[model samples]
Target: MITVLVIGIGTGSPDQLTTEAVAALNRTNLFLVPDKGADKHDLATLRRELCETLIDHDRYRFVEVPDPDRGPDAERATDAYRAAVAEWHAERARRYAATIRDQLGSDGTVGFLVLGDPALYDSTIRIAESIRDDGRLDLAIEVIPGISSLSLLAARHKITLNRIGQPVHVTTGRRLPEEYRPELGDVAVMLDGSLQCKQLLPKHGDLTIYWGAQLGLPDEVLISGRLGDVIDEIEAARNAARAQRGWVLDIYLLRP
Candidate 1:
């Protein structure tokens, strides 16, 4: 049987890994870590370090899979985004299939180490789904959850995620409109290529913003204040850090 485990490691921190996640890591005969190319090696390196720290299996084979880059393009007619992602996923599944065949001999356990929670803003589940579509993963597929970026932000800041009777909306920064706000309570924005908060509060601002870059890393940066007060600084700092690191993974929370 082929047991495929999707484990969430959570934000660059070894401590962020839950007990169950660690157990799953040790149980896997194969580990799949995606190389986001040269630009984002830190991400892949972090996953490697986590395994080195928590896993002590002699037969634990590590496979660095290549990610298919979805270039900058609009998804207009023919559902370009869906098609592009499908192609990318199929390529990933092919790689996974080859790895499975070579490593486990068609029946063993493998773990796909995903950053943060696999179910949130992560495409690993999709890739696993692709593997399933190919009828490759006949073994039990287990999802081991871990701390998420939002949880990390809340824990680091010592704040609750939402008001007593309020709802929180988690969304990508790309979908943000010209004006953004916490509809009824709070909003957690991720995958922010553009500073959605800045665009929303261009000039007029009266909201509480909590931001974090590289959330759980050593070079982590956090800023919280009135939106109008720190928007420029946040933009400058975010830009500088992106230049320094070549890329940045960040998320922010807004409450009103």
Candidate 2:
């Protein structure tokens, strides 16, 4: 059986890797790195850097997989989006299965470094499930959790994710309705390419936003203030940072 370790490297920061995650890294026979092309080459570079810095031995080999494009049509309709994502995941499963069969030995261990915790907004788990269900390859999956970007954002901003006994609502930028508000407690937003905070500012003028981009990495940016006060500044800074680095992984928390 091939053992697959879905290890979270934690926001591209080697230091954020837990002891268990490091141990998992050392046991890896192959590390699968996804290449998101030139515009997002920094991500691949960071993964390579982590391997170079953390792995004590040279037994592990790195394999680069070209990520499938989500396609422009995916955004036009809900059904189209689901179909496109499903197709992309299928392609990923095929690639991963082929890699396991060719690059990994019968009992070899393979690792994929996730950005944050494997269970949070990551498709690696889903892809692994697909590969396991196919029955083409014997697989044993292990997950090693790491620090989440939301946790890092909260830490950097010196705030707690939840109130005294309230719950925290986590959602993506696209799924966040314009009328959404944190009536219960705090709200954390991720994968927000549209700067939904700006849209929320008018309705939630009293809300406070603690935002961070590229957390736990050098050149990280953090902005915190009343939504109305820092909306323009965050927008400008986000645009500049994305232009400078060619990519951004940003998350924010909203509290009333």
lDDT of 1 by residue, 33-105 (tens): 8777887887777888888898867768888878767666343344776687678778888888777877887
Note the clash tally of each candidate. Answer: 0, 0
Off by over 4 Å in 2: none
TM-scores of all models?
Answer: 0.91, 0.95
After superposition, the stretches of candidate 1 with alpha carbons farther than 4 Å from their true spots are 73-78, 178-182
Find the 10 residues in a row with the least total lDDT in model 2.
72-81
lDDT of each: 0.81, 0.87
User: Per-residue CA lDDT of candidate 2, range 188-238, in tens?
Assistant: 998888786666665687898899998888889999998899888888888
Candidate 2, RMSD to the unseen true structure: 1.5
